[model samples]
Target: MAAPKPGHRRVLAAPIGLALTVSLAFLPGTASAAPQNVALQTSDGPQLSYVVNTKADAATIERVKKAAATAGGTIVVAYEKIGVLVVHSANTNFPQQMRTIKGVQSAGATRTAPLQAAVTTEIGAPEYLAGSPAATATDVPGAEPLEADQWDLRAIGADRAAKINPGSSNVTVAVIDTGVDDTHPDLAPNFSKSQSANCVGGVADTSEGAWRPYDPASDYHGTHVAGSIAAARNGIGISGVAPGVKISAIKVSDPETSLFYPESVVCAFMFAADHGVEITNNSYYIDPWLYNCLDDPDQKAIVDAVNRASLYAQSKGTLHVASAGNANHNLAAASITDDTSPDDTAPVVRTINPRECWDIPAQLPGIVTVSATGVQNIKSYYSNYGRNVVDVAAPGGDKYQIPDTPSKNGRILSTMPNNGYAFLQGTSMAGPHAAGVAALLKSTHPAATPEMLQELLKEQADNPGCPTGLYDPDGNGVADSVCEGPKPVNGFYGFGIVNALDAVTAP
Candidate 1:
């Protein structure tokens, strides 16, 4: 496959296919409580995954589970704490029919792909890096061998922060993406095997080596993200933002498609919360729909279930940091066009109200939505922004924002699979930087709640305000994006660029 686009990272190309025709007439609060007999046999069509949501009560869950079985749905996993059940069923009308069951709050299919098998197609091998960049640094004494090329570290003051406090070993930030390569030298020192798990099918598989990438070459996204957050500060390779902290993997992306579905994401958050994880980095959005609308029952169910899981994690003291996408669209805008929805199958182009349609986990409340910045401290050309949507900014890299390093590459350099290092850019890269700083804060204040950690992140950030004049980084006459709000908090940079030094030293 070709290199991932600048804004979208690790997203596989959507093959053109037909969508399964399903009814959209299901409405919440309109279903009857009366019992009805529905046949319980799996259909001949491809098996699909669905999320049956109910009130967070044992009685309600039990009732739903019985109803689900009668509706031809086999329970994959049941999260009683959130009242969300992952179910596999071949019946095409499972979602529509489940919505009418008593005690069932909202239900819908999680992905456009069938549940029988994951979509795996190796179009081509990803371009891999075998060695460090051709850069020598004699000025920055005591720095790691490849740290000089990590302009992102210096940009966030993480280079200076590490001297004061390299975070704490007890603090763990979960990388909830594709699986990670824990054997890499740079990441092996700080890798926490006990906290890692494979959550590909909405279930936690903690077997030995289960958290590794399914394919080393194509499934290298999570390894890069882990290296950015907590790669050890050893002498051989690049140092992470919070080098002293431990990092774990929660593999959510599917094998070949690399798509993150709602069931997997919900499992990741729940697993992180139940486990001792203090923070989570979500760089990818939920698949199938780029923007889920609240008015639509199916989309609304996805939004509700994901938000419930995230809130549950936050309540349990886990801070969530997410990327603000790469579309470059203002999330605070009145309207926007989404042409890539139902991406696992065919898509329908349509205009949507931004207020009603949201990019899950990122646009969701309480998630620290981070925008991407370059070496110049300006918003990356492809970074999505909004007045209240973006909460902070970090180095996600810009091909146009040339760095002064020997390699002169504008992207971030981090660990890849098989003892390799590579340069890649996206808001996917930006979220981990913030997560690293949040981990540093967690190390400093071990007793702080998720709310406190989030406040500290914004309060300690260095506010650069918004850029003056039309925002155009390409030097072309055409304007790229518009900034909003005052200097301290704006659409582009949010509260400001995250300050790693402050994170380690803040009271």
Candidate 2:
């Protein structure tokens, strides 16, 4: 793939910041507004919103105290936390106003939209082939030679951890995608029922529920992604990056259509953050909108919410990783400018390359955005690149046809839903490899914060065949020589390709 052309940074044109304010006054008839709350996304944690109370003022407090004295109702839950207040009333019909509430200017519920399911097709069992391998020669006492017909799990770093007893049994990685097939023989053993949820359209048994665990639906994308993250390594057709790590399958996408809405993504992020998932993998992206300022009123509010949620997860040390995008455009490029006049003269010229830019949630700050690379450690022909936006790259595979050479086909081989296997390609396939590696690093370094883990991974990456003297115009380059360029991190290959052993043992 060619390097992205230089383009100007275009900030998104939207209002994203505005403080929320609320006002409340007592009214007749005690009907309530169904517990108004706002899901706030913070930089330091997951989602948190305020619970409004109509009787929080000094006068109301006094009245409540008197009412409790008279009614023998004492406040059990304390609202001592600043900006947090609660009210209790015996009048089921107690009339309360919700017009004014501090820190809560509006009452809106946030939910994750539906995610599209991944398509699945059978690729058959592995066939041992006589060819050069990516890793050093090692012997599995009783294991059979890997089948060539099977997907190449080892090339993408899954086999390394598998050799060391699969993964740490205690760790569970969250796969927040379309629902998964929990009954698959290769995946059932490592799936955790307590940590799974099908958040698709808030429905049960319908099309949305088909992706839920034990459901007879074919929503296999999450299963595939999860299998790649931690498929059971019990002498099966394939192994996962963290074979022993239990999987928390959170189905947020649709099983039939591969489509997902933004709200669902937000909900999924919050769910993972709130849960004890040490690592969350997002292999999807939204179309890129030109630079929207970090403080646009609406954008800022949404981003602030997301950042707050991420911050909350980080507080507990959860790592969030996503795919940079498949579009081969510079992430920092300016929006397309139309030069043609009114329709009478000539046609208007709009930008032809939409996928050229990095998509949202991935482009969101603080999240790891990964790109894809092919065999021989070169960038994948369809993989996107941006020194400023993409944080790293991994072996996602390629499909190049070389004359008389059995066509060098590239596809990421990993576990799928049901008792089957599959070959997937795309940055989607690459992101999970990185996520699994991050999980391994987290398991190895229990005390490290998410931020620390990210830094460590970059610091321990291994540089392969990157070019020298290819300066990034953005001035983000830290090293001058390709070999010496910023030893641990850079825009392209964010710290270079991940080194499993180095990341697992980093000081």
Candidate 3:
């Protein structure tokens, strides 16, 4: 998901920002340096985004609001329930100044980039082969034209699950990413427009089609993810994992940079929780830091705000399924080198302790963290994994582990904007497959809580156990990754690969 890998059509690299591995010793000032200097910019300086966390009480919130105003910050949206406020201020000192306030728990800027900068993200063009028809109605009875190309669906038994149950229309999975094109023929049937909204700048914009991608051509990430979760089984394009469940779009990615900042992501979680959304598929991480460290003030603040928001959503019965990131680092490792932080500005290479620095929403408690697998049901080469970190595994595709399908493309194929289709690979793609299965479980057990659904999902998965001998998929003599734990639950496959057939059929 970190910027599309070189061979893919496009990279929805929000959650997996630069998911490549690089080694560097711990930089001395990396954790100690302030995110930004207040002296560098005054009240008249460039506008910046900040998150202020406080006690979730009316009195405390009010006091913080006043303090924010006095610090030269304007309230973008106040999530009073979580006591998280998205603030905009030109005062570079606002974060430092707000920290001094009595009620403020944590305060920091969300990014290094200014508000007006037209951040450029290299979004690969949508891939389409002219005259290459996806499929015909006669190919697979009720299956879509591209159904044959979707090895991912069969790998997880989603193709068979459809016969038993397509999922409950009452259950909805919110794709909280770039945006979703509900207008796509494959997605329109099961799209929940009423529940969808654009939470771009910490505000919920419910305008008609407000959840549509800012630019369908390049902002196709969310739509692709949505298609994998709930694209209808109509004889049109590709079919999603849980083709009968409803899906809503909560656009949180910035239009220009395609970045999912903390404020927008927090707003999205709060929106989904309040809107009766049963599940959320978080394919993108709250950027610019790949790992939000507890030691860093700004990073810690991001961790706090996002944790609060996710907790609020969970309490409202919203089960969160997130990608474990594309970086192949062992999440449970003692130390990991991350060269990508503050991606909106210049990134600093630093060594981080995984225990303290986390890949939020995914590593956060209660989230069903997913790692990617390929056609062979082995861990994808680029998926991040840890024995206790990953909750489940799903088909996110592997170019090296080619499938025997017609397309023969080792990537997940799903609906794109403007009736298009493309192949993408990442834990971003894997999370949706698990999310779709969760939707099926929710559909079957209408009264199940988020905890219950998670348990059921894990119970129903097929544990392949750890791979025999060296776990090297690319066949390199050197091990690409080490598999830890017992077969039932390991770093590479978690509780093992998700089973869609079991999801809908289990008692």
lDDT of each: 0.81, 0.48, 0.80
lDDT of 1 by residue, 342-398 (tens): 778897998887766778777666778888999989998888888876888888888
> Residues 258-292, candidate 3, lDDT per residue (tens digit)?
88888888988999999999999988777888777
Candidate 2, residues 1-507: lDDT per residue as tens digits?
111111111122122111111121111221333332422221222222212222325654444333333332224222221111222333221112222223322111121121122211112222222343222133555332232332334454445545654557677788777667777766778877666666543222224334454433344456667766776656555556777788876665543433343334544555666667788877654211222223222222233334444445556667887765554444543443322211112434445332222244565545777766656565555555555456666665545311121224566655555465655566766677778788777778777778787776667656554555553322475532222235344444665776555555446
lDDT of 1: 0.81
Runs off by more than 4 Å, candidate 2: 1-153, 156-158, 201-218, 254-257, 286-302, 335-358, 401-408, 465-488, 505-507
Off by over 4 Å in 3: 1-44, 117-139
TM-score of each: 0.91, 0.63, 0.90
Top candidate on TM-score is 1
Clashing residue pairs, backbone N/CA/C < 3 A, model 3: 1-13, 4-11, 15-284, 15-285, 465-487
If the candidates were sorted by their TM-score against the true structure, best first, what order would they fall in?
A: 1, 3, 2
Please identify model 1 stretches exceeding 4 Å from their true place: 1-44, 116-137
- Which window of ten consecutive residues has the lowest lDDT sum in model 3? 20-29
